[model samples]
Target: MNTLYRLGQFSIALTFPALAILLAVFGLPAVLLFLSSLNAPDFSLTNYEAFFSRGANVRVLLQTVEVSVIATLMCVIVGYPTAYIFAAASKGLRMALLVLVVIPYLTSFLVRTYAWIVILGDGGLINTLLLELGLISSPIPLIYNRMAVYIGMVHIMLPIMVLPLVSVMVGIDKSLSAAARSMGARPFAAFCRVFFPLSLPGVLSGSLLVFVLCLGFYITPAALGGLGDAMLSTFIAAQVESSFDLARIAASSFVLLGLAAVVLGIFGLDLSGAQDSRPHPAWKSPPDWLRSFGAPTRRVKELAARHRAKRWASTLYQAAGRGHLWKVVGTAFVALVMFYLLFPSVVVIIMSFSAGPSLHFPPRALSLQWYRSFFNNPSWTDAAWISIQIGLAVAVLSTIVGTLAAYGLSRTFPRLRSTLTMTILTPITIPSIVVGIAAYLGLLKVGLIGTKTGIILTHSIGATAYVVVIVSATLANFDRRLELAAKSMRASPLRAFTRVTLPLVRPGIIAGALFAFLHSFDEVVQTSLVSGFSVRTLPLKMWENIRHEIDPTIAAVASMLVLLPVAWLIVFYFTLWRSRPTVSGVPLETAS
Candidate 1:
């Protein structure tokens, strides 16, 4: 019994060191940001007061909320039908569409956002098409407005909505809708009454994710919305980039953090009604006395619709391939949405092969000249090398810390798990612009600003959040018996864990590392704030060129960036697959 107690204590004790480091890394900057906001030659609330007192600040905050709400609604409207079709799709088709969605999702954020500029800018694809068809005298001013912001944001957010919605919809019992139809309900009515409400949890979750991400949007709006349509992040960034007012910047960061918290609340919302364990209120046949005489005409119409649905349902039941008009439309719309999701990446790749010095819709000719330019340019290549180093460093540090934190959380008491989870994700929960300001202020106080070591440490704070989430989830499914078996054979707990547990969860660790690397490699908001002239990363370098309207070379760089992650993803899994043993000491491929 004493040994068993120590064994349990040993598992719990392992979490302490990781938890302490996580606390120091995330907590210190947070405290610093608050103190920085109080800096006004002495400790004071002047910055907070100034941040709130300005009318423009309030208006921008309001505008940010308004745009976020509209964007969330638009994502739902565009994503619902597509999700429905995907949920009902055959296995092959569903897998294919999922890959299409993930390709752009895994691509560079700036690269995709930048492609929209080329497609919508002056004398760009849309305008060229308009000119060719003689629809307008000149460009229609498509690039720098709320319309463009919505288009770019919605295209990016659509997949976020579809993924969650499809997961929920696929689990819904089709029998519920079929039973409703057989009981004289119309197709649309049955769908509305049965499936849509049940899918609300997913809708709410996805909408909230999109809304919070929209709050922190820096690139898409900046590139596409122009100056007049700036987001909250734009103002926050302006404080860092233009004004250098660290106090007000930190204050503004807190304000944006508040709004993001409100959106995260939507994730915790319980709209699915699945928790009501009690049986639903009893139903009985309707009687003439309960029916209102004045509603007779409405009842007649409803009955007619039901009759039509019953006939259609019969047809669908008898012939498996038959589908309704709405289904057909929904499927086609999903295809178009998939194309939209992939379109920007496609445009970047195509333009990478262009021979010209400027961006055009369909290039008159193609060559590898721009690619060669990226290779030959010392400035671009050196910056990329720096980014690669930073990414690797961040990936390693974040993965180690994150894996430990995940282990700690898994061994912690269940009652405390939710609080721990939220605490670990706090860095991600806050807007990046806020984090950037906080990191910049915190690092400067320690004389680490512009240093590679400082930048790598700063990047790891955010990267660790991703690793913790991924590794914790993977650990949730892990079997403890294998480790127990090793322990029963007289192995120490640490040895048991290393020998038995780590191999099974290695994939998750590697995945966490990969994500951390990509995030650090592509990191912009924080890097932009902290980096000096000597510390230009590839993203920062491209950002400078983007503002100056330097094309072609950026297109080539974007194309390579787009494919690099995909290649890494394939190679990582290939190596892992080869390392796994089969039933008779063969690899998986040859075992059969």
Candidate 2:
């Protein structure tokens, strides 16, 4: 057993090159960012002093906390019921709604953010509607405030809140709630006393995730927020563009990192909340009166016997009073939620065909003007190609590195695995703005600024974290006995893994690769910082355009981006859901 273990360990050691490259690219830049804080006059804490000296600077912390808390609370309020829907829905409904939740999530962040601008701008859809209805004489100020920032953040954070909650909620025993209802408890009463408690851990997990991510959020806040409403991310960008003082940049980066670290410490990153503690199953049965709601009032037999065809209308009226109303309301609420999630993408697609400018919805005439404009511009086409190439490279790079790291860590015990997993996800936890600053400073030290190599390296660092998380999840449910059986036949370790384990986990690898590609293509913060004059990608083009003009060309570009990922995702999902093994070209029956 010792010899076998050593051979397996040696095979795992082959993955170290990928790991080492990650350390050099990600780890080294982090070190340089720290060194930047120490580069002030005579190695003193001058930059640190500057940060703390201003009351206004300190307010950014308070403001970040305030916004994060508000956004997190809203996510919980809106997301809790929605997550319940996801976990509790039937198979077909669950698949469709899950896609609804995921598509905008995977859509380009800038494109999604841009959608909000169109809907909330002065000449936007809402304003246009109100003018026609005589609700207001002019457009309401919607898009450039703390409120707008919160809306966009919630839209982005909803899935992050729901996914973890659903994971925890699914494991819950539906029997407990059913049993309570079977006796005499009302549905709401049974849920509050029984179901809600078991789901708290998921709530805690998801709420913490939203809060922490919101603390470091940039894109939405930057796009939608005014100067007074600027989150910490906005200031970080300002510091980056305005100063050659590396220490100032580093100080700002450290503050962002420091806040993130504190958040992780408080929440501990185990959003599932499965490890440490859980709500005790301590609630006893409620009073007899409380249980009465679950028992339907007016027995079914009694009602049928008492009410003849002559009184059928009265019986129908009683049924509506009992439970039919709330059911209708709940279904309507879910529909509205789905529409809100889809609205921005829908608006962006429609606006892409506008014959005139200003990006208002329901244009007078639809035309392919923007599409033609996009194709005709050499700069746009060139940038599109560059983005595609970079995305593909980042995809391959992140997938290989992440899979290797995940395989090595999966071979370890749970405790060590958790620690390493957190380390790998460090890039993700830090603000992207901070990441851009650190990479800019670090690459400058190495004279790699304004280079595609620098952008690729930075993107892979950020992108690798997602691949690791996704692949690691897939490996957790993996069956290891097949590899053991190969080893029992005296197959080489590499052959055992490749010929057995790898094939089983290929779907996960492919999924991770897709995410890596999307991350590379949509990434704006780090790429914008690193690609000074040498490289330009599609996202950079959009970012630059949005800062100056709301051209329909951007909407055309955004629509293309939205359709590409969504189309690929739909194919991938249908393939996965619809796929089945075949025996001699006949599909094997899948027993439900």
Can you give the TM-score per candidate against the true fold? 0.86, 0.87
Q: What are the per-residue Cα lDDT tens digits for candidate 2 across 542-591?
A: 98887777456998998888897787686667555556533224453431
Q: Which pairs of residues have clashing backbones in candidate 2?
A: 184-291, 185-294, 186-294
Candidate 1: where are CA atoms >4 Å away?
Answer: 1-22, 36-46, 178-184, 266-327, 572-592
Worst 10 residues of 2 by lDDT: 583-592
Candidate 1 per-residue C-alpha lDDT over 257-278 given as tens digits, one digit per residue, 9 for 90 to 100? 8778766764563222222323
Q: By TM-score, how accurate is candidate 1?
A: 0.86
Q: Relative to the true structure, how large is the alpha-carbon lDDT of every model? A: 0.77, 0.79
lDDT of 2: 0.79
